[model samples]
Target: MFKTIKNDLPASIVVFFVALPLCLGIALASGAPLFSGLIAGIVGGIVVGAMSGSNIGVSGPAAGLAAIVLVAINSLGYQNFLVAVVLGGIIQLVFGALRLGIIGYFFPSSVIKGMLTGIGIIIILKQIPYFFGMDKNPQGDFAFLQVDGKNTITELLNAINALISGNISVGATVIALIAMAILILWSNVLSKKGKIFQLVQGPLVAVVVGIIFYVVTQGGSMNLESSHLVSVPVPDSFDSFKSQFNFPNFGALGNMEVWITGFTIALVASLETLLCVEATDKLDPHKNVTPTNRELFAQGTGNIVSGMIGGLPITQVIVRSSANIQSGGVSKMSAIIHGFFLLISVIVIPKLLNMIPLSVLAAVLFIVGFKLAKPSTFKSMFSLGWKQWVPFMVTILGIVFVDLLWGIFLGLVVGILIIMIKSYQNSHFLHKEGEDVDDGRIKMTLAEEVTFFNKGAILKELDNIPADSFLELDVTKTRYLDNDIIEILEDFGLKARERNVTVKLISERGIEENPKSYIEFFKREIKRKYPA
Candidate 1:
């Protein structure tokens, strides 16, 4: 891990900057204490990072869980909610032990790509309001419908109206534009000139410049308001900092509602984490595959630790993980070190951090968003044909129009439907008119793996066979057949007798003329494989 310290250190700083505002914002969105978000971030980075198999994935309090956390906190009380979080973590550990991580692999690549692209679009859209200094909505809220009672489009329109009516802060716009310019220049030009430029990242430089701008323009018409800056909780002293931590209420353990909430958190957090892990692995330059089960265990541990103290539920977050990757993170050290930075900054330099403008961070996120949803990505997916493109587009639209989980769910549904359609189409190979044998027999070859999905297609073909016709049932290449298809074949055999149809069954075992019973044949085959 230390071998990549040079890369990890700079990346950690970048991730720290990216994570700080998000941590506070997510906590605020969840109606939890702002410090709790930082606590989750710290634990996610240090504790989970240490245990996680991922070299680049980062975990923390996610915006996706903000609504659930808010409701949970309101219904259960803060202390009881913490109990749920701890229990949720325990459930995640059980998930890991059961090797449920295989669930991540089931998500189609197109859906995963769509997820990344959709999130990128969201990050860009969400930041637009902040870019224009409309700070009514929390930065961490990524859902289409926001806590502020406006959707992304309406919020954006409102920001534009504010700009037109001269109600928006000119200071924020100016800072954001400057930050974007600096980032563009740094990435395209300056970073190429020297190692020094590479070592000192553009986002950090932009943030520093934003702070300087904030200080210089104070009391002027162009000065940004406190609302436009990062808002980390400022504890007065050690005692105050110590007081920020809230312990979970053990008394709530017996509540059935608490258990339900715990399971909900565990399910949602695990899904989000697994999805982010897949997306992060795709984003990794090294293309490293994170062990999903280990990731669940690590996340569960982090959440447990975080809940025992004062913190929100945790999951592997794409924004931070992508930020880490974009900033050249090569090891888990970057994630761990970023946790340390979150810890140290909240204690030491929170006041300084508060001076940095959200507009500048918005500018930073703009670049990240663009990288994820590049126009080239769209063209590439389209070129892959409708099979991949349909789900990909659906996911993007769903994510942009709905929410993260909903978008993924829609895409997954579409992906599965596409698979079913393809399976139906490819279920068998039928001999063309001229290809039939001289004996006027019709040949139908079953696919390698015929599941229940192919039952309808197979049945339709069988039903169309002419009376007194010769039919060839070929299972030469079939490795597995569903019982549904077996039943359909058996029924067809009975129908063949009525129609006076001659049927030939071809298999690896031997050719048969009208099998007596499909189940009996399979039973005999099983016995052939394992003789007494």
Candidate 2:
């Protein structure tokens, strides 16, 4: 870790910048104290970062759970909600210990891709308002139905009108555009010069420039203040810093609502963390696999610490994880260092941090969003065939219009439906007898594994076999013959004599004479002779 400090330190700084505002924004969205988010960010970094099996994944407060946090806090009160969060953390620990982290693997690759694309689109959509200086909703809020009574589309519509009517901050607009230009230049051109230039990243430069712009343009026509800037709750003294830490109210432990909230947070946070781990692994240039179970354990530990300290729930957030990857993070030390940066900066130069414009961070995230949901991604998925593409598109649309979990659910359903259709069509095939064979003889070959799905086709083929015909039935390669198919064969056997059809059963058991009921043959375990 120390050996890679040269690379990890810079990457950590970039992730810190990316994480700072999100922590506060998600906390605000969750209806919790602003400082609580920072606490989670710090814990996710220092605590979870140390324990996680992932080299590149960064854990922190997640936007995905903001809505749930908001409702829980509103109903249970802050202290009581902390109890639920603590309980949730405990539940996550249980999940990790029991090796439930494998649940993440059940998501199809297509669905995962869809999820990544969906999150990217959401990040872009959610950050658009911030980029435009529309302060109605907090930064990082990505839900479909926003807290401000407007959905994402409506908010976009409102933002457009606001931009047209010049109801925007000139300072924010100018700073954002300039920051984005710097980022584009840094990523596209400047960083290629050498590692030194890469060390001083575009976001760091953009933020410094934004701060200068703020200091120079104060009270001017292009000045930005309050809502247009980053807000890190500044601690006035050592005691004040200590006071920021919150604790759970154990009195709420008996409340069923608290338990329900705890379980909800545990399930959602674990899922989000697992998904982000997969996404981060995919984005890792090093191509390392994250140990999913260990990640859960780490995440669960981070949440427990965070909740104990009056922090919002934490997850392996894609936005920050992506930022770390894009910024060239080399190891978990980057995440740990970034956590320290958060801890130190808020206590030391918070006033300076507060000077940086929110628009600059918005610009940074906009670039991240663009990379994750590139137009090329859509085209790539579309070329993969309708079976893969349909679910991918549906997941994107579902996430855009509904929510994250729901979108994946819809996509999974579509994926399974397509699979069933293919199964029904691909169950079996029929072949004609060779010219060398006697006339009126048909050779029927069973598929690799004949399930109930093939029963219909088999019945149709059986009906077409003319009377007094000789049929050669081969089950030599067949495996996993379903009971329904076996029953169909039994019925066919009963009527074969009436049609004067001579049946031949070829198997490892050797060719048998006119076979008895399939139920008897299967009960005798003849079908089990074939390999699966």
Candidate 3:
């Protein structure tokens, strides 16, 4: 891992930058303290990332769980919510131990693709407010309008009006534009020139330029008080840092609300983690498979640790994981080092960090979001056929219009319905035989695995057979014959006797004499001697 430090370090930095705002934003959305996000990030990076089996995936506070977290916290209170988070972690550990991690595998590929594209579109939509300096609403909510002040569409309109009103700062605009330019140039132009440039990612360069631009625009040193800046929480000293730790109220664990919240968190966070792990693996350059069980264990541990320290629960997050992989992270060490950076930076130079500007972070997120919603995503989904495309399109629309879980459920239902319809259609009867049985000779053939649905067709053919004809019924290749079909055959046998037709049972299961009833032949010997 150390041998690739040159590459990994830069990648880690990119992931770190990308992760910073998300942690805060998700925490805010979850109704948790701002510092809670930082704590989750620290634990996810250092603890969960270290324990995780995935090389490229990054674990952190997930936007997917924000709604659940918000509801859980609101009902249970912060202290009780903390206990639930810890309990949720314990439940995840149990899930992993029971080998239930394979649940992630059952999702259809089309649904998964839809999920990725939906999330990408969501990230872009959610971050638009931050990009243009609108911070009234939290970032995770999918509603068109926000509980805070505006809906996504309405807020977007507001942002546009604000832009026209010149509410955006010139300094912020300059830094953001410079960062975006640097990223675009580095990725599209400089990256193709040489191995050296390729090794340095666009996001990393954008970050450096952002900082430099902040300095240049200010004409001096970084200062939160005087310039556009990041807002890292201030912990005055070692004692102050220690004071920040928060413990869950064990006494509240017995409350019904607490348990309900725990179950909710466990379900949502685990699903989100599983989905992200799968998605991130798809994006991994090495095509490495992440151990889903281990990922659950690691996330469980991280959430437990984080909750104990006043942090939000964590999960395998695609945004950070993709950034980590795209930045060239090769191992868990890059993730771990990035966590350490977050931990130390808060204590060492928070004021400097605070000067970094939200616009800079917005620019980075903007790029990440665009990559997810690219036109290629649509083309790929369209190629998968109606069986897949229906569910995929439904899921995307559900997420865009409703919520994530709701969208997934709607898609799943449609997928299941489609499968059932296909099954019903495929179960139809088929016939094969000579044009007709001439000269008082009758012959009929049954298709493989005759079901009750085929009984109707069999009866129709049997009714047509002439009286006083020599009949032959062939079921040689048939593996399974339904009870209803057997009943139909038995009834037909009685009619054949009156018609003077001699019925021949030509089947893999040995034929029986026409002297007995069809029902009797079907159940002959009761469980004793029968045709092989």
Question: What lDDT would each prediction earn against the true structure?
Answer: 0.90, 0.85, 0.75
As for candidate 3, its clashing pairs are 144-151, 144-152, 145-151, 146-150, 146-151, 230-354, 468-499
Query: Can you write out model 1's per-residue Cα lDDT over 1-532, one digit (the tens) per residue?
Result: 9999989999999899889888988998899998999999999999999999999998899988998999999999999999999999999999999999989999999999999999999999999999989965448888888876789999989888898899888999999999999999999999999999999999999999999999999999899889999988788989998999999999999999999999999999999999999999999999999999999999999999999998999999999999899999999999999999999999999899999999999999999888889999999999999999999999999989988899999999999999998887773544334235566578888767778988778888889888878877777777777778777876777788888888877777898776557446745653553355
Clashing pairs in 1: none
Residues 70-153, candidate 2, lDDT per residue (tens digit)? 989889999999988888999988998999988888777788899889988998988777787886445767678776678999
- Steric clash count of candidate 1: 0
Off by over 4 Å in 2: 427-444, 447-471, 495-501, 516-519, 525-532
Query: Local error of candidate 3 at 234, Å?
Result: 1.7
lDDT of 1 at 218: 99
User: Which is the winner by TM-score between candidate 2 and candidate 3?
Assistant: 2
Q: What C-alpha lDDT, on a 0 to 100 scale, does residue 150 get in candidate 2?
A: 80
In angstroms, give how far residue 26 of model 2 lies from its true place. 1.2
Highest lDDT: give the candidate number. 1
RMSD of each: 2.3, 2.8, 5.0
Ranking by lDDT: 1, 2, 3
TM-score, model 3 to reference:
0.83
